[model samples]
Target: MTMTTDTRPRTAVQLQTNGMGDLVWHAEYFRCIAEQSQGGQVTVIAAPTTMARDLIGHEPWLREVIDFDRRPRNGRRGRHSGLDGLMRMGAELAPKRLDRMVMFSDHPGRAVIVCWRAGIRTKLGYGATWLQRLLLTKAPRIAMYDGPPVTGTYLDATAFAIAQGFCSAPLVPHINVRPDALARMRERLAAWSQPGFALSIGSSEPFKQWGAENFAELAARLARTGAGVLLVGGPSETALAQAITAGIASELRPQVLSLTDAPVADTVAAMSLMRACIGNDTGATNIAAAVGTPAWVLMGARPPLMHDPSRMKMLEGASLADISPAAVEAQVLAGLA
Candidate 1:
């Protein structure tokens, strides 16, 4: 509330310290907001994690990253001794000098407190929990069509509208891809005469895993048509990815590659290389779409309305839980050919 809305060349911080999916959605909003900032320095001050690094470092817009991992442990709810973590981070920051500060969290439980402490003023956010609304100068109800509503009331639906400006258009969530990164991936894919595809059959959440046997069937059908396959996921997914590779050992397996890392950059790069990507609703699915690979994202349990469109092939559906692998294979083969 201290920083004025001036056109000064100043620093801005986007605080998105929540779930990876929410962070990804917030990143897209940050992208649009950063573009309008002209040449100001932009940074992401998130809890230290691999996902934060991949997003901030790989994002074409952000210039800096600050880790305030201990903020959660600073006070009430936080398990740490006191505000040592808070003070440690405070010593690093200088106050009230920012041009603007946008608090981009689905729900800013206490994330707003950190922004205020760091000398941020111009707060922007969507849904709030209790004290959250008091922190933002502007809070818009973002609106968008997420297929048919799960409930009759918009408030009751999974698709909540976070409105912005005077525009009535719904937010089309997306992740940005670097041209240089894309150039490298494109060159790599060029080695093969046919366009390649990515398949992800893993998730941190056990319920989200779509199983390897199902993927193998889809991989085989794509191979028959000449599209190469690359499987990417977490290290724990080795057993699953291996099973998939073995299932298509006759031909498709040789074309497939497996990669896993906590930050999982190798898998992300693999996702980018594919002309088309198919997978269960999971981190890699988001990574593929964020990196610009046109995807046929498959989902199980979760609904499709939860996904963003920059990486999705234009289609009509709410979630991929009902998605058949053959349906995805047809889309992949056609895109590759």
Candidate 2:
């Protein structure tokens, strides 16, 4: 088989900061860009978050992770505020001499302006706004309401490069787990008699979360089957984790563990160690799916397109409370099987 190849110029990708799930999908976009760039260095310009660093920092194809501060820095009247900050960012990036820039954000007019001021010749992004078209050298036609999943649209943004025979690798989110981290996760799970399942019971928004009682029921059921449950979430979810932990029967309580305060990287390592995951639509669930764990995500009112259904079992309803524990358990068992 003859493999086509194209060595493109250095590329930079500007990503959105909607949430961790969005970051995970954007990481996949980075992978596609890297693979498609041939040997060219690829840099990721994104919000400074541990999630962003952990997702793509270790990829060999990644040259750098530029921290793009979205907040009002240097005070209200400082040069780092508003349009001035965008210009400053452009000035800093100008030295890098980026050849082409890809914007994965919807309202990236400022970013497009930054790229233009930075002397980047080619700017590719998705948007129908006049400013988007006027600023971007290659603004592709996109329908936000009647389009594929957000991730799919992100992939489409790179269609020009792919068509030029620059990318052939399968488009999937890739996150490398450090060996030491993996070892620590294994040590932590050493007491488990069987494979463990990660249960994520928290969401950034309260409405996105399924009832804690539902998670407790699912945990108890999994415990009955001899599978240990690892409760995972951020610090804000400590209360919810405790509620689920306390709901488990006294005997089964030993099989459940909570790491709500663990670092994002450690959580990713732990997710990779788990046999599968069952959770509400959140960053942790997205990480589980991205790390190759079979994730059964509870999709409440959020659009199903926000997630990658092909990588996990998505149980969608008008609301998170509408999805019963039994339905989730069935999907979890199927994934484990």
TM-score for each of the candidates: 0.72, 0.84
Off by over 4 Å in 1: 1-6, 9-21, 36-38, 56-60, 70-84, 127-130, 138-168, 179-193, 261-269, 306-324, 331-337
Candidate 1 at 110: error in angstroms?
A: 2.2
Instruction: Kindly provide the TM-score of model 1 when superposed on the true structure, using C-alpha atoms.
Output: 0.72
Candidate 1 global Cα RMSD: 5.8
Candidate 2: TM-score?
A: 0.84
For model 1, which pairs clash? Answer: 141-161, 141-162, 141-163, 142-161, 142-162, 142-163, 143-162, 304-318, 304-319, 305-318
- In terms of lDDT, which candidate is strongest? 2
lDDT of each residue in 208-259, candidate 1, tens digit only: 6666777888877777777777776767787887788788856555566555
After superposition, candidate 2 runs with Cα above 4 Å error: 1-7, 36-39, 72-81, 138-170, 301-307
Local lDDT at 47 for model 1? 63
